[model samples]
Target: LILMLVMVGLLSLILGMGLPTTANYIVVSSLMAGVVVELGAQSGLIVPLIAVHLFVFYFGIMADVTPPVGLASFAAAAVSGGDAIKTGFVAFFYSLRTVALPFVFIFNTDLLLIDVTWVQGILVFITASIAILVFTAGTMGWFLTKSRVYESVALVLIAFMLFRPDFVMDRIQPPFQQVEPSAFTEALGNAAEGDEIRLVVSGPDFDTGDNKETTLVLSVGAGSGEERLANFGLLLLPEDGVVKMDEPSFGSAFSDSLSSFDFYGDDPVQIASVQAPSNQMAKEWVFIPALIFLAFIAFLQRARISRQGVPA
Candidate 1:
């Protein structure tokens, strides 16, 4: 996933070079966004459409700093009396310091402030600001003063942990338990009120008539199994011990997608897997250890600064 995204970013950068902002955005969005969306689905990743577009946009804008055709670099060179190509190369390397941000937010949409409460947004902003600063310090090889090689590496790791606390938590405990499609009702009933259940369904596409699978995260409200499914515009019928989709109710959330499904046809739509959210500790708990590690690095840097009589 990371390598594919990196390639997409590089492609966006190359395609966007020398283009104006609006044109660059249009080109990347039209050409690259769908590629990302397709890649994400193939990887079983539920990437938000907005995230994919923003990812392309971020890299597209980086073209301004890239070498050879960087218009912004040419402008900067005119003002600073530097070589245009050299300035662009330097700027491009500097821009790479924050390059990980787009990738970070792609996997962690909360960083984009999507679907977050005001308090959560504020916390995200604060932590994101600190993480960026630490990341910059790490990459630039200076915090209080020049850093040791190990300190720089540790700083980068700490910054990553701060940016993606859940990465560690996910490794420790998988986020979801996959349930069989036939047993989706049982899983839905077992979930707590208002919790999310990820449903995977495969069916023919409405536009292209090609077979495609999509993932939907439905909120399971307090109700019986049938009622909960009805709330999401899904009606299931059991035939020979296998559950099949029925025509969705009018104007319901799943109407558009479910409407195309032919329950009785040879290639009828079917539920693939139902993922129930697992019980795990809050991801924020990881911040504690990350901060502790940051403090340790800070202490070491401070000691170096004291020994060298360097001003912090």
Candidate 2:
């Protein structure tokens, strides 16, 4: 996976050389995302998948401003008569946020729309946006007031809370108690047919009534035992009625009528109860804290530069 991602990043960077960020993302995503899907990861993780591509795309664009082929830097230097390297560095620093934003959304599902609840999602959006603002302000040293190191840190922490998914709060509350056997029995009885005889048995053993089992008994009265036995097997009880035969008997009158009488078979008695998740809650949870982290980093960078008396 790591090797594949590296190759994808390299390809995206190579292809992104002169393309706009959005165009570069589209091109690489179209070309490489299929390969990832084939590898068995969910398609929903596309945000992160595309983020890697975009990271390479950003670097590819930066290559133009980095050194030898610094076209944008050269153009600016020629116009302003400034040093090309310095101009390139300035541009790179100013656009740092662009490179970081993708990572933020990629790591945080709330930002990327993974298993997010409406109220929680909204809260995440609001907090992350504020964190971004704080980060930008700290970086530029141009918010309502110049941000102190501690203030920047606080802002970052707040952003982290906003972007991180609140698992405790986001958890889906189960709407009902576990299904009881009695309930299952009631449901089965309600669904039983008129001719069916319901026997409640216990345990995993079907032969011994120790285990719970529901049996449907059918009786055939009109045919010879041999004829009935030919059509359907019979269960016989001893003359004393204390013991029942383990296997079907062919000589009984009941066996004779077995052909004329319809048997429900072993299907209903073996019905297994099903348990389903509640429809009221979500199956997944997404954390929004990532956006805050991005904002925090951006703000930290800005603050660090400011402390050095440098323009962010």
Candidate 3:
């Protein structure tokens, strides 16, 4: 997923080069947003459509600071009486930290404050502030004082952990547990409104008659199981001890892509897995180790500064 995001970001940067802000957003959102959404789903990571669009838009705007054809850099250079290309290079260098924000928010939507509680919002604000500061210090090679090579690396790692505690938590405990497809009805019934249920569908392709499988994340709404499924354009029924997929309704989420699946062929379309979110301990525990490591770096930097008699 990260590799795909990086590739899309670079592509957006290129496609948006030398374009005005409005034109840049239009081009990148039109060309790159769908790629992220489709690729993310194929990779079993269902990114929100808005998030994908914002991700591309972020990188698209960054083109102005990139080299060779940096309009923003030229304007800045004209105002500062500096060389345009050099200014572009320096701007791009500084932008590396900013580049990390889109990736961070992609996985940790709390940074965007989506679906967060008041307390959670405060915590997110605090951690995000600290993370950004530590990240900036790491990238700039300074923290309290001059940072050693190792200290800078540690600071960056600490910042990442702070920004995304779930990355560490996931290693300890997976976020979602795979449930049998037979339990889809039960899972859907138990799911709270607005929850997402990941479903894997597989069957023979309608056009090529080849077998294919893909994951779909359907949003649960306030309704019965069948009604909820209808929201995503899915209709599943139990027949002959196997769940069979019926034709999707018009103008629903599954109407377009699910059409390729041969629902009534020899090998019928069926749900392969139903992934339900697992209950786990708060991810904030990872913050302890990250803060400890950050303190260690600060202590090391402080000692170095003292020994060198540098004002900090």
Candidate 4:
């Protein structure tokens, strides 16, 4: 999965080189977006559509300034009377500082503005912009003033936290508890109200004529596991050590959403893994503290620069 995603990004970057902006996006998105979707499906990764598109598109744009066939690098080199290859490498180094954004947003779709409210969008925008600015400052070793080695490292960490606060929170508190497939019934039966149960399933996708893996997040509400699943438009029958889908409710969310995938095949699907949600401290709890630390670093830098009488 890791290799395939990297290849997708590299392919998009190469395709974008030497192409006009409009044609670059059109060609890369048309050719490479489907590769990401297919690879993501095979890997059981629920990457958002917009995230995949942007991931390829962003790297493609970056390629225009990257090495070998970098048009931007050549143009800049022409104006500077410098080596095009050398300028391309330098441009590539700077672009690497921002390339992490696409990867972070790929894992955390919240950054893509998917399903975000106006207020949430504003907050994400503000935090993400600040995080990227701090990230650039650290990568370039300059902010309010030239950053010390340790300060630059801290700034990078702070930027990552601001961009994905859940990373730290998840490390401190696990997000899910793995449940044995054999004990799935007992776990489901005893699940708490409003809890979410994640099931990883794999089976043949007839539509694509390929084996595919997908994840289903089922809500275990104030009743039996089956009942809550039914609410989400799924019907299951588990007996004699086998689980089968009886049938999805007509016109239901499950049926509508997965109509094309056909995860609920005629044969019993393979249960790859099961995970139950764990109540953990919200990521916001970490975000606020990280933001404060970042502000403190900026303050220290500004004060140091002021003492040194550096020009603003």
Q: Each candidate: what lDDT?
A: 0.85, 0.47, 0.86, 0.79
Shift of residue 304 alpha carbon in model 2, Å = 19
Model 1 lDDT, residue 228, Cα: 87
- Could you say which candidate leads in lDDT? 3
Model 2, position 106, has a per-residue lDDT of: 47
lDDT of 3 by residue, 89-118 (tens): 999888887678999768888888888999
**TM-score of each model, in listed order:** 0.86, 0.41, 0.88, 0.76
Question: Candidate 2, which segments miss by more than 4 Å at Cα?
Answer: 1-15, 19-27, 30-65, 68-70, 109-126, 140-144, 166-312
Residue 33, model 1: Cα distance from true site in angstroms? 2.2
* Weakest 10 consecutive residues of candidate 4 by summed lDDT: 255-264
The better candidate by TM-score, 1 or 2, is 1
Better of 3 and 4 by TM-score: 3
Error of 3 at 202 (Å): 3.0
Q: Which residue pairs show collisions in model 4? A: none
lDDT of 1 by residue, 115-159 (tens): 888988898888888889999999999987898999999999999
Between candidates 1 and 4, name the one with more favorable lDDT.
Answer: 1
* Candidates by TM-score, descending order: 3, 1, 4, 2
> Taking the tens digit of each residue's C-alpha lDDT, what string does model 4 give over 103-199?
8767778788897789888988888889899999989899888889999999999998988887799999998899876666567878887677877
Q: Show where candidate 1 strays beyond 4 Å.
A: 202-213, 235-269, 308-311
Clashes of 1: 0
